[model samples]
Target: MKELRADIERAGLDTLSGRKAPRARVLLIAGRPGSGRSALAGELVRQVADRYPDGVLRARLSEPDGTRVPVGRAARELLDALEAPAPAGAAEDELGEALRTALADRRVLLLLDDAADAEQVDALLPDNPDCLAVVVSAGPLTGIADVRPCTLGGLDTKSAVEVLSRFTGSVRVTVDPRAAERLAEQCQGQPAALVLAGGWLAARPKAAVADLAGQLNADLGQGTVVGRVLRLVHASLPASAARTLRLLSLAPAGLVDPHTAAALAGCSVESARATLDDFVAHGLLHPVGGSSSPQYEVPCCLHPLLSALARDHERPAELQLARARMLERTVRLLQSCRAITETDSLRAREKLLEMPRSLRFPGPRAAADWLRVRRPALLASARLAVADGELDTLARRLMSQLVRAMVAHFGTRAAASDLYDVHGLVLDVAERRNLPRERAAALLNLGDLDARTGRTADALGRYRTALDAGREANDPYATGRAMESVGGAHLELGDYDRAADWFGRALTERLARGEGEDAARLYGRIGAAHTYAGRYGEALRNWRAAVAGHRRNGDVAAQARALSELARVQEYAGRLDESLRTCQEAVEWAGRAEDTRLQAALHLRLADSFQHLGDPASAALHRGTAERMLAEEALEEDSEPEHGANACEIRSSSAEE
Candidate 1:
């Protein structure tokens, strides 16, 4: 930090007490790879922390290979950092605008580390001058205007020696000053190289610095000095640990925990964890903080080197086997997670118990927590699995399990947006494998997500394609679901007549399959569609048939649902007396079914009917009853049961498609 004091002061940034100057509030810290640009950025952050009291926001703008991360993803990360709500399915321009607005009037220090080019950084720059951005890249960001550039070279010898001392201890460096100088010189005075050299020496306390210096000069004569040092460090590890190090390059987020490492190395969890700890001890991996379990990440600069080593030294079969193990482990874990979430399914409970204890979660909450923590890695694995064509079977099952797990943890509607990318991957796999059923399922799921996220046109298109696929597969379940989903989408779009037509077709499939209970449910859905279209007579007929079917099936809850819909249609048709009778019957069935919410809703319907009939005293009585029932149930309006399935309702726009 002291080495950059002159550059910091020369930037002419305003103090906290002063108004920021009307200039492009960006600073460029340009340097070559391995020149410690990121380290300098961190030091700058510490130095300027007090000046920017609002917050310090940091985002990685590029991969280690200098490939730019998508601007939209970067924008989303920034919005998350700011704690701003990003609208679902929003475009890049909208997200950029939100980010600019979030930065306005705030004193933030935005650190965009390892930026690839000018366009990448320009889009994320804050419009507010009060905010400051420090972009660290390999060269000056040419297109961005009004920027101050601070080019970084190799750390001077003194700073470089200080870097080594920090890792290996001052006593060690001082005891062999010449050897230490020789090592620093070998590193070309680069902080990154020095840190690796220092870490290697720090790990072997008894090894002389001079001997190690001679080994570096003799062997590892190719590649950058840092790359060769990494290879030396890697080669020094035990075979098991070395294999673990190479396999970790496959980790999706460049981060791994004990369980993931164990899966990759085909070792016991304890052994993999110990290997990870040893790697961290030797500075081969860096510890990433804020995890329940200890987590370590391979440094980005070492990725290509490690990957190359793995390819050269490890068999393709071995690597593929390792990846298969990871996918299988992930699939099992997700299956267990989904099992626990099926609170009402006795069979699911039995299956959960049958799973290996290691795969099983203690409870649903534990499963949910794991899902939240491992979402990124899990998604990344799914993507890679799909891309690896030979793993299509595993990928398909993995994606199916993920969707189920997410639905269980986050509910269908809430999980849809977050799992959108996974659904797309599922579609890709389905197309590649020519699995019509899977393709239909993926499209239907995506459509449901689009519907919930307000992409009406997209939802309709997905539903239509899903319907075609379902028909081609000759899958009744998929076809029925797709038909109903199309109706749901039309209902969302206010195309009530079309919704009724689709719902009627779906009902025909359910009835043909002799799924009496499901048919009853679909009848109610068809009734809703008719009601929405103001075809009260058609609604009444379908609801009456639904009521009869539920009665035959001995489903009191379904009977109550049908009768409630019957009452609604009667009221809409101005048959007040009939509606009152139907509502009373619905209330009786609701009480029998112990559905307090349904009872409250029926009472509310009775109240409305009485009020419309000009009977204020009766209306008040029913209204009071409705309020008391709702209070007893503690029910919120439109609140569905957290457990148990319900008849599909073709509700208004607010319904989940």
Candidate 2:
């Protein structure tokens, strides 16, 4: 005990004697909930907080029972403790500004414990950066942009043992060090749990350490809630606060702000804020964000129990309503992020007309930024909405919107893998619920992603699995799609024979399904494979078949590609004039496809044809146009960088949604 205290004090001296505060002075004591944050706070206050003697005040931003606490009420409580009489009905901003004024020159150590987010921390920051403030929260209080953050994690084995030994005698720990350490590990290194167990052991002098460990292990095995004491405190809250706590159990993000919470609970923001304050007073919540809106979080110590209880008691109707409202908002935000994709297009006015007032985005960039900011919460919401146990069709729609929005606004990497995971989860639930189409759709979507990212082997496996599953389920469309993906993967791996075989199989399936467009695509793949294998005769035959099929189906894009291949074969066959004429027709078809890459390729090929025939003027004109178009394409791609701006826009937009 003596050695540990001495070491802590030495470290405290190191903390206290450091340089003066920066432009933003925030001491964030970050750790997971119930890791002895309060005890550590008190120790730091006693030892080193004296540097600021103006007025050292303590505030509990989160309740011990795992609920959100509000900032206005927290500020009022701080003011009351500081002996500063606040006017009745002071708004949060007024109270926050007042608190700032009170601590401006005082150099007080404001110990805001269990803070939920940066919003609450920002509200209480001293006007004078010289004033030191220790803001403790479960996670990083990052919303406050430039503040210095000191994150704290779990205690080490030695410190945890020493702290517990303070209650259980040192002789007991020394005599059974291994048992003592194992006990600490079983407690998950949570200081509060260790302290409680150690105190109970201290009262029972005859209790063996091994016996206690066995007892705890037994309780865990039996699901008797051995690590659930933190939830009992939550269950003891008043009815209003308890309901608020349960509603927050559905919070997509780990933290919740007042307005969104109000929306979820079908109450006013003031009511939600007041409920948060009441819970904080009762030690049931923690205040999270303060930079923008007030937010709160349930401590991790209380999370497991609270989650289990929620699973048992949450109201289905309320949850569904909240999920639907959140999705509508997400759809609006997604449209905003894809604003550029619709500019000057037919859908521009239609999209604008469909947008909701709540969809106010500063710009397309801001909309994109929101997605990046709220990616985790968006993902969680999708998962939770699917598990609503009702609204299966809406779940499908939500998943589709999620996929479209992710691919459009942030590209494949945004949620492609996560979407695949969620789709799998959804597929399982849907199959159990007897929705075969939903299962097939999810499987086929995931299989598509698996193939696109060069996961040829994995894609092949997924395609085969989905094919068997869909066939068993009598879903011909999915079976056909799966065969196509399997063939695509083989093509990517340069397995010409296997690729052609799979493509033929897919063509048969699509033809049976009467899917002409898809069958044409399969024929084009067969032609391309033959070309890659240098079998010009077989390639020419396949290309003619593909061109005939695509023209019959009026698929200009496919026809263009087939015509280009046929022209190349003719060029190789020494029929220069006929090849040049066919190349011109391919260029015309390429323009009809409206595909920039194909258009560029056709232009380059046409230029080569002209150059081969010694037509310098024609060749020069084509080359210049291609070069100019390529430069413009490169500049456009570089204009919006893939990193900071684009990613931030997506994140920020999602937050708004």
Candidate 3:
């Protein structure tokens, strides 16, 4: 790339090197679809990245279908790259501000690729003068000030021939220099066209450059040099390989793997893989990275041609069926990805056995790695399926599996932002299909994510809607869950009275359904709301009920925690003796529960109570015991051997009755 794109690369580097501007240095790399703008931008970053010192942040500003990526989503992605927190459900302006703030003090390089317009680029530009931004688009950014676009065109004749040599050996090029030059000229010095022509020659060792050049000269079709060359090369493929190439266009984001290709083409994985590699040899696809799974990317320049071919040769129903197969395959893979993590579930293990070996993950780590790498494509698949509109059932299943896979691998909190989007998609499907149960579930999930991200008001609205939907669907679990969530949101908003009211309503639902444990938890929530409202008498009653319920359930840990809360409220209500007795009982329960930390905390509370009562000797003894317990706990933690410096493990478990 450095040799072929020498002039543009040098100019871009020079523009980036000059940091004397008042704001971030902006260099726009504008070109046609296959002019290699992305490749050049990457090379420039590779050369000048160290000079920035902070880091280089890259984002694609458009979807593969030419739709503009929302400014908020783009900002959130950049913020994620910076390892900065982006609040879920945040407005575009707020996220933009957060992004600018994150880049303010850092000397970072921003590579905004495939930008749709000047506004998209402007919104994400860092305010810091020390930063630099390279914007890649198909045309000049008209609104950005003092910025000159480094416009790209086809490669030079010499460079075009060199590109050909890389695919076809130099010996072939050296043998027929004139014919190579003629072929390069016929390609209009376009790198993509040259590569395709070279791949054609490389595939047939007996065919000379003159043979291809003569063929192109005689067969002048009604298109650009690239289009004509592509048609010729595509026409030369075996029937199976040609169909595989056409189906590759259906791949989300133009990213294809053997499994996806096989599903799309109705072939075996090995056959799909061979066809993909063969496409790579023909310059129709580019291998992504040197991964064992072998993913390929359809070049941006050729995507339209392939899609056109598919439309011409494939029936609409056939295309839809192929898409359905791909999505179904994706859903199963996601199911296996998540099920692999449930190592303790015999049902999950049995499900894993039922799946084909190609679909199953080796272990949790490999499953997580696959999920992380395939996340973008997976997300794109959901969006595409939803937009198709006719496949709502498949869309729902895909989103459900995607959400579960993400949560199983990345945790709820870490994946909240993405889950928020998936839940919205679910809501879209549910509303369109008019399915009350699914609508309620989607709303509940969205509300939960909103609450986790501190959007209390938004969460409150979603919860209320979910409650209505749940009741309409006669779903007791969803209704009860929604009521509880509403109470929690009210608590977060400091409306303690309303929170308590909602908790009571939810408690009634739980009790009526004979859900004892959930009813007990609701008692604790009601107590908390009452305590916050300074209703100590009511708080005491509720806390006592919670403690009794936990005792009945034989949950010593819960009982101890409940007793501690009851003691606090008792002390608040001036029943010092009762508080002291409650604290002692809590200590006993904690000990029985084998909760050393809770026991230590209870002992400290006992010490405080004794000190307030003027029993100096008892207070001192309790304090000493508490200190010894904590010290012993710390020693136990220190005695454990350390793993490797970077070694960390995340274990997730489900609760058992």
Candidate 4:
């Protein structure tokens, strides 16, 4: 690899080391599509990674289909790689600022690969002179200052021959050195072409090097060397392998696992695995991921060729069918992925048992590992399905399962950014199909994420729109949810009167639907909103209602919480004796609920109320009890085994129900 671009590597390293600019040193590795610029940049990163003690970060600025990835999305990807918090629904400029701030003090290496233009790279460049950004683009970054483009071309003949030998072996190249050189020349020393040619030779072991060279020379047409070589290799594949190769184009983002391949090709997992391995052997596919569960990536240079093959050989209907089948299979996998975490649920276990062994994850850890590894491709699958505009049912199923699986494994907060995007896709499908119920659902989800990320105004807009859609669909559940969400958004924005009104509306809906628990939650929300607005009388009434509702539902913990709120409202109303009585009642309920934390908190409240009522002895006694309760709870927590902690803890939204 060093022999292939030793000079370029040396020059890049020198430039990065010598620079002390106001911003990151920018190095542009410009090349044609198949000239191995990405590979060379990767090699340079490997060579100089130690210089940057912070870390190395990479992001692809363009998708496999040449679509320019949005700058905000790219920045989010980089932040995720850094394990930094990136707010959902942030503008591109904000995300860019965040990215720069993240790298401002750190000596890091940023590999901005396959960038579309100067602006794309500039948006992501850090302001730290100690950092370096090596950008791989198809052409010069015209607008950037103080940077020179290192243009890459085909490899030199000697290095090309070495690359070839790694695939075809040395014996063939050594026995017929002239033919090997001719074959390398025919490939024009392009690494992509060389690999394909080498694979072709490797496949036909008995055939002389001259034979493939003659075939390529005869087949030279109005196309790229890589294209011609890909055609030749593809043409030589056995029927099953050829079909698998063509179907691989359907894999999202050119990322394929055996299960996806199996689904697309309508074959068994074992058969698909064998065909994939064969493609790897012939350089038609590149092995990625770990050896434990191997995945493959189709080379971007070959995407067009494979796509053309699929278009020519496969019917449109057949292609659509294949896509639908792939999505359905993905849904099932996601189901199993989430179900594996429900260890206590017999229904989940039954679902897992019904699935094929290959589709089921061994346990929650393995499921999470698989989800992490496949996140990019799985997201791509959802995006592509939505963009297809013809598979709304399958797309909806795929997205629903995707969201649940992410929440099950990564929790909502950790996965909020991705969830935001998926919810947008869901909205797109809902709008296109004119499905008001689904639209309302999607909007509510997006609003929840927006609220979590502190975009309360945006969340308010979404929730209001969702409310309209729910009303149009006459879905009481959705309508109630939208009302509560809007109220939560209003509460966050400090519009407490409007928040209370909306929460009251949601409470009415819940009551009419006989949802006692939800009604109790909404009553608490209304009470909180009233308290925030300094309406103590209204707050006390709502809190009393909340307490009564929870009692009717036999929810002792909720009743205890409601009663504690009532005590605070009573104190706000200057009813000190009433506050004391409410606190004592809350403490009793907390004890009955077996919620030690709540019990301790209520005792503290009781102590404050006793002190306010001028009862020193009772105040001192309750304070002592509260402290003892807390201390015992702490000891119990310390004694618990470390592994008992659930890694897949789902975080609830901070927004009131």
Model 3 C-alpha RMSD vs. true structure (Å) is 5.6
Kindly list the per-residue Cα lDDT of model 1 for residues 522-633, writing each as its tens digit: 8888888888888888889989989999999999987998898898788779898998999899989989998776777777677777777788788778778877876766
TM-score of each: 0.89, 0.56, 0.92, 0.93
lDDT of each: 0.80, 0.66, 0.86, 0.87
Order of all candidates by lDDT, from best down to worst?
4, 3, 1, 2
Model 2 residue 308 CA deviation in Å? 7.9
Model 4 per-residue lDDT tens digits across residues 1-657? 444334333444435678545678788888987788888889889988898899899998988778888999999999998888689878899999999999988999899988998899899999987888888999999888777788888888898899899988899889998998888899999999988888888888898989999999999687889989888888888887888899898999889999999999999999999989888888878898564567899887788778888998999999999999899999999999999999999998998999999998878988898898889899999999999999999999999999999998888878999999999999999999999999999999998888878888999999999999999999998999999999999999999999999999999889888999999989989999999998998898889989999999999988988888898788778898898889899889989988777777777777777777788788788878878987998988866433311111111111211
Model 2 earns a TM-score of 0.56
Query: What pairs collide in candidate 4?
Result: none
Report the C-alpha displacement of residue 6, candidate 2, in angstroms: 12
TM-score-wise, the better of 2 and 4 is 4
Q: Candidate 2, residues 1-657: lDDT per residue as tens digits?
A: 233233322323224678443322556666665666666766777776656666678877764445456787678768876867355334589888888877766667778887877877787777775565667777777667444445555668887788778877788888889988887777777776676566556646777676666666655543323244334434445666666676675666555656456666667668988887755544446775423335576554655555666666676666667656656555555556566445577776577657654454555566566665555556656666676667566556666666666676667654454566567766767687876666667667666666666556776777777787778778888878778777778888889888888888989988887887877777877877777776777777877888888999998877887788788777666667877898789878978876555666667776777877888788778777777766777876766434421111111011232
- With a 3 Å backbone cut-off (N, CA, C), the pairs that clash in candidate 3 are none
Q: For residue 111, what is the lDDT in candidate 3? A: 92
For candidate 1, the lDDT comes to 0.80
TM-score of 1: 0.89
| Local distance difference test, candidate 3 | 0.86
Overall local distance difference test of candidate 4: 0.87
For all predictions, the C-alpha RMSD in Å is 4.3, 18.1, 5.6, 4.4
